[model samples]
Target: MSSGIALARLMFVVLGLVFIATASLRARPQSDVLIMRNGDRLTCEIKRLERGVLYASFDYVDGTVSINWAKVARVESRQLFIVQAEDGSVYEGALRTEEAPGKAPVRIEVLHPAQPARVFEQGRVVELHQTAESFWKRVSGNFDSGLIYTKGNDTTQYNLGVGLRLRRERWNGEVGFNSTLSKTAGVSASTRNESWVQAERLVGRKRWFYAGAARFLESAQQGINLQTTLGGGAGRYVKDSNSARFSVLAGLAYQKTQYEPASGSQNPPNAMAGLFAGNLQLFRFKKTALELSASALPVLTEAGRVRTYVNSSYSIQIVANLWFKISFYGNWDNRPPATFSGSDYGTSSNVSWTFH
Candidate 1:
């Protein structure tokens, strides 16, 4: 089974390469150019500039490469782009770069005719996206997993995770899933499963209508076999800069739970709860990404309990689009169901091939 799963992951990589090739072949032409430090001049379509890297697709090359912006001596493009800076300012226009001697940061020149030329250091440029993006261009995400086996105890473990997102001018949608399982000879097996779907619609520059539903099933922790949450509310983007974003959200949440040992288990609460959530996302774009997030739900009924989730992750690129990821997860219950603990936490590392 492990071998089969590994093979499947390999197939995914192969298919991802094929898709990139096809897309590059079909990409619309643009007046974009990138000059590398090695004196290589590439005539390509600059799909986006994010974090500290530039994503470019070449008509001649079969696959796209993420170029470290620092390694790029200059870029000339006439294609319209939505550029965002670390200061939360945004512009729509082409980009020009003035090379600096040695490793000094290149001066980025934003050519906005209506507005004067805005100059910034390379690091201050948070994100750039082609304004001509299509419906498909707004889609991106990734999935990955890792497996382990122990011969001494005849034990095996595996963790899997996946995420997908679609973004447009007015709204965005995201879906995610994660699961972990372990088994040992003569020992009861344990498993955890989680999934969520979320959507947000822009109401202003930094405010949005937000909603999501999530479900979790865990047999080893809290003796919980299942828990589901559904809610909706508003979100405020505290920081909407190019390099990072921070958001806070609040509203109402409804929760239902089913504990393990179903026959005689303590029935968990089904209550209307006040929910609060926040998240911080940072993209180095060069090769690293970081995310920190949490959710809290306080029950108002006799339950007198609070449920919370905290998650953190860091990822670094290992190859073209394959990234090595380390993630930490925490589940907490101020008042747990009978036979359950108050909290559970763990970490996992895996490799994933991400796509956009």
Candidate 2:
């Protein structure tokens, strides 16, 4: 066979794999079905509802269940959308537009721009949605898992994640779980688990630009000592780097950590704060691109009296599906008193394995 013909066949094989993967990622169980407004019932799993489109998963024998949000007068669901807190707690109720003031730390009420704005002298009211308990049941078990390894230090880590999204017409509210484990020599093997969720509004003609993500992170670290933190970040992206538009993002996070030695109770909470440096990427070349970013998180206590450190990272993409990343990390422990000797740096390179 000619080299040209062989190359064509290879491309076809890759493309076929890609399509199969996409289909699998989107496929759902046959039992999923949703009924829309106008008394019309459909047989499909709702993929996602964004803008006016209600994406669904349907099978031949199961029938079709798809509905547009605008056309949806009301939803008939054996399931609904609900929000779960980072504490592994679940809240079951209906979405409401008005929440009583000065009652809860997180006040959730449905967003209303048309409702006359009113100021409460008592407290603040945050918009939130109300849904049924079963909503959480239907969307359960959609989780992801993976493992990552570092060759230089022979370090390996595993991760598990669960994600959820709440759709309004053009906007979505999301939340989920993220947990990880790492093992290496010299460094005490550790595991960190974080649960976070975010909300973003779709903007632009094609809804390609995800305005931003308001994410929360609640994590615990285990090793010789156990430590935990509650933190979060907000991120946004600009679409179409080839154009004049350069997307930039800024974020801030705070964490309270307590360390408990195996034999004793937890230590007092220490403050950890992070600041968004910046990110810029230009995708001009078909197979090449340039991206730069820097973010720093520092232990926010007095340098000498309190254990402190700053973690930072930077990365650049050299070729299609390939990139290099560098991370700088440091930490201090005050218990030993004035022992400032501690810092580390690491780098990683990733290559794409595009089976699809």
Candidate 3:
């Protein structure tokens, strides 16, 4: 036992050292210098600036750090970057900073261009993604977990969620998971599991052709044991910028489902339905990002049944790599299997960690 303990401690030390040596975002073979307002300088790789934060990765013990973009006094780097301004101007060049005397606003200079250095205010520059980052560094997402317990009702619930998004030159892909399990003494355990994957190819700049698959398994009042669906659709982005995005999607879906009636009466335990589905999604990036999505599916046949779901959440950055999210979900089935309500809704809050 003592030998085993000693080996575990040695392994832990090795892992700690590895973590301290490597940063979350891989660095290219160039050193980027960043000057802070307090006259501090860091020889780190400037990863990207998004949502009012500048991310830097260094080969030191601190790994990666997020700096308020406004706190950066100046930066000098020869690496190419994709810079986007709030007024929709884009530049592909290296960046240098100019601080004029007195209270004049600092200006960002676009280098290597034939024209004289184009200068802009700090806040006007909304996005900067380094071209030196590898393909994988362009991907981003987050994971969330939630829990709820009721003493009087003797019930406890748990939730787990994860999402990943990847954007290539002209293509984008997203994968997401949302799962929940609930337990109560002297009663059946309830579980809801959902997973979805979507792929999109950009048409022009703001439009996309997309296809996806979804699998769902749910229990409790709604009473669906399994559901598998395939869908294809087109989408349009009304507003697409670094700080926020708004999009709409319309699609056709084919689904097969198996369910036990909520009232325990046999009302066709299986179903095959063709549906017209659509959704509207909005995302904002800030210290507190607000996300909203709503979807609806109407049965093609004369069954006159419809399914609608709405989700809204606010995510607040709490600390390094962590966020607190308060979310609400509502699902409706116009026509349930048998003797079930037409609605299911819940509100929850979670602390989520993010990695890119």
Candidate 4:
């Protein structure tokens, strides 16, 4: 068989195995209970708690429903979970709420099978996720795509983005891919592609982390056939709350570039650089979300040369697990190969779907 065919078959087999494993892990009794501050009660399977929203699934509901975490007064669940507190403390166990008297503050309880139960005030708990034996059960991701065509100019543009995240008790992993293509009747096609994988581990319990990442990029506008980067650094969260998060990192990176032959490059192919980056996220419950990230790399081996990247996205929830998103990306290099552009930037609008 051709190598392409064999690769496709292998991918299918791997995906099938993952599906089976996830299905088995998700086969749990829908016996979890929630009590609301206004005395409303629900019996459903809890999915996760993120950004001040609690997600749950009911047998009669067509799709998952989101609840305001602040409005919840009590919870009971038998399934295991990994929970994070506002102070960055991590816990693993089943969940319950302590029964309190009228007008008293609610307290959450984490019940471990072997260890003593841990309790915290409801307001102190920040995040929660159901845990299972299968790795697939700890994975979440989203996909986005956009296309635009203009008949008068015979112009067409396409965009695609995919992201995956794996969450563990004290570590996390992420993978991302993005591509853009543009074609016009009488103009050369423009294309750009980017992919990256990153892993992060929590340090001492104060929102500090260490991370490592590898990134690859190709840009027609910049005359880059490919550029690769490997970097590692330590970072800390400047702000961590239900509504927003901000973090900054500083580290070192090594990068190599392969320029298009047409550019007649004279610069060196490799460089060592200092990396500085920051990321911010803001959420408005199920209504809207915003993300911004920026990175700057100052070349150590090549004097007076620096590279930068900026990305921003805004998403509005359209319905359950679906959103309308607008995104902007910009890449810049202070110095470049002869006759090549020093910067590339673009904007896109997409429909996105997320799953866990």
Best by lDDT: 4
In model 1, which runs have C-alpha deviations exceeding 4 angstroms? 1-26, 35-41, 59-62, 70-125, 130-134, 207-220, 240-243, 261-268, 283-287
lDDT of 4 by residue, 39-151 (tens): 99999999999888899999999888999999999999999998888877788899999989998999999999888899989888888988887787888777788999999
Ranking by TM-score: 4, 1, 3, 2
Give one digit per residue, the lDDT tens place, for model 1 in 1-356: 43224334544554464355336434668568888879998888888777667888776676677887767778888876777666555667779997578878778888877878878787777677766556556566777788878999999888888776665545667766777778899998776666666787766433454666555445365666557778877877777554678889999888887665543545445878898999998986556889999989888663668889998999988877788989888889887765567787777888887776
TM-score of 2: 0.35
Q: Is 1 or 4 the stronger prediction by TM-score?
A: 4
Best by TM-score: 4
Provide the lowest-lDDT 10-residue window in model 4. 2-11
lDDT of 3 at 312: 81
Better by TM-score, candidate 4 or 2: 4
Which ranges in model 3 have alpha carbons more than 4 Å from their true place?
1-30, 35-42, 58-63, 70-138, 207-217, 241-243, 261-286
- Every model's TM-score: 0.76, 0.35, 0.71, 0.92
Task: State the lDDT of candidate 2 residue by residue for 15-116, as single tens digits.
Answer: 443344344443335443443335576655544332233445466634223344434333322333332221211222322223335433323332234443
Ranking by lDDT: 4, 1, 3, 2
Looking at candidate 2, the ten consecutive residues that score lowest on lDDT are 119-128
